[model samples]
Target: MTCIADANVLFSLLVEGHVAHEVARGWWDEQPDGAVGTCLLTRLAVLRLLTNRVAMNGTPVTPTEALGAWGRLGNDPRSVHVEAEPAIHESRFISLVSGRESTPNLWTDAWLAALAMSLDYEITTFDRGFKSFRGLRLRLLSMADK
Candidate 1:
């Protein structure tokens, strides 16, 4: 299936020591060429977390190193870069964030869901919160650490 990864999935896939790395890798490695997708938002979020001192347990990769890892992943034939067609996704993105006082993080979540729903791609992640978005397809992986 064509799938777009959530930030957590991308983060785990990038970090070999991450608890979900093995499972994330196993799943990632099985995808056919052009099946696994990434967007600018999730890719940037993974980079941000990878270089965060506290988030990385005090040994953060430099931005240069972070981009190196990201570039390697991007070089894989199985990985694809995808963009939301703003004309179609914009209204869905709006509907997703409206009618609620959302936390700052939910805006990105809503955008991802809107992207996946609009493009007919399933979101692959460990985050259960994606379930909150109706009509979104999710491949909810259980994190190894938990």
Candidate 2:
């Protein structure tokens, strides 16, 4: 099945010290080439989180370092970068946000889920919140709650 690396899993995979790093690595290491992909949104999220002081827990990572990590990830044969089809992506995103159960925190998740749904790519994430998105193909990583 085709899958996409969501920000949560990408962040964990790039940060060796993240609580779920090993879990992310285990999932990442086994994927066949072209089986999974990354979109611009998820890659940017990883870059933002990696460089942010708060997200890094006071340990600092420079922009250059974060970019290096980003580069390394793209080098992997298993991960291909995917582009979004703007029209369908925007349409689906709006539909999700206007859904009956929509919540403020769901904006990004909704966008990502909508993008995945538009492209038929399953999202691999640690966040169970994705369950709220109907018809999203997802691989909810197995991990005890932190």
Candidate 3:
């Protein structure tokens, strides 16, 4: 199955001490080559989280480390990188947030779901927010810490 790793899953897989590290890594490793995929937005989200000191509880990784980790994921031959197609994403985003008061955080979630749906990929993550996106196919992972 082609699965898109969400920022949360990718972050846990890359950051050793993350609460979901083992669970994410185990699932990630079990995917066959080319079965795991992601889009640019997800990549950037992971990078931002990794380098944001305040967001990461004041223990941010260095820029070099962030880039290195991102590169590793990109370099995986088994991984597929989906294009950042804005039109499709925007259409889905608009449909998703319409008639609802949404914060920027929710917009981000919509963007991720849009990307996955556009590419016909199932999203892998622990975020329950994706449940609101009826168009999204989610492989909901149970967080290790939970």
- Give the poorly placed runs of model 2, Cα more than 4 Å off: 100-104, 144-146
User: Lowest summed-lDDT stretch of 10 residues in model 1?
Assistant: 79-88
lDDT of each: 0.88, 0.85, 0.84
lDDT of 3 at 83: 66
Give the TM-scores of the predictions, in the order they appear. Answer: 0.93, 0.91, 0.88
lDDT of 1 at 2: 89
Q: For residue 70, what is the lDDT in candidate 2?
A: 90
lDDT of 1: 0.88
lDDT of 3 by residue, 1-146 (tens): 78888898988888888878889888877888889888888888999999998767789989899999899988887678876665677788788878877665788788778877877889898888889899789998995434
- Candidate 3 wrong stretches, greater than 4 Å: 144-146
The true-versus-predicted C-alpha distance at residue 121 of model 1, in Å, is 0.4
Clashing pairs in 1: none
Q: How many pairs of residues collide in each model?
A: 0, 0, 1
- Model 1 per-residue lDDT tens digits across residues 10-60: 888888888888988888877899998899998899999999998788899
Clashing pairs in 2: none
